[model samples]
Target: MSASAGSPGGAARSLRSLRDLYDQAVELPAEERERFVAALESAGSSHCAQLRRLLAAADPSAESPLDDDPWARVEEEEGPEPVPERIGPYRILSE
Candidate 1:
């Protein structure tokens, strides 16, 4: 599919924006980090669960061997989300 072929859902759009905001907010310290995390968690009610699962999967500390692949688990939970046909060499696996 082309770059413009699929459109992102509102939740995906919101998560992308929130990720950008988190990147910028990293500069702030103390209670700022807590507030930022809280706000993001609150704002992404619809997408936060899947986003959290993705985040955990991406984290090295959480890595563990499982009978089922993390990507498969993600697919089961998220169903599908708009992703480009290719993101460099990696494509989002879907059912």
Candidate 2:
């Protein structure tokens, strides 16, 4: 059955379509991506701006959240922990 625009199924389909568009756009060379986005805009696709932003964020040269270790700063601020003197039956020696 076909989903109406306001239905949950319709929303899912729209999300799927956007994901598919993103996948396709991401695979294109950087130089060609602008043209692809422009084409979508010219076609009056509501997702064009969102797709452009997604493409920009996915660009290889763009800084990625994964590039930095989030915990690194916390670790630096906390510094290294001191070794415990003893544990249960064994005495702690070297770190």
lDDT of all the models against the reference? Answer: 0.60, 0.88
For model 1, how big is the CA root-mean-square deviation? 19.5
Supply the global lDDT for candidate 1.
0.60
Q: In model 2, which regions exceed 4 Å deviation?
A: 64-95
User: Lowest lDDT 10-mer window, candidate 2?
Assistant: 56-65
Q: Model 1, stretches more than 4 Å misplaced? A: 1-37, 66-95
Error of 1 at 70 (Å): 18
Q: Summarize candidate 1's per-residue lDDT along 1-95 as a digit string, tens digits.
A: 43331456655666676576545555566446556556767876444455445544555555478645879889889888776777799876763
- Which candidate number maximizes lDDT? 2
Clashes of 1: 0
TM-score, per-candidate, Cα-based: 0.32, 0.62
lDDT of 2 by residue, 1-95 (tens): 88975899998888898999999898888999899989988998878988988887877799877999988988899987788888888999988
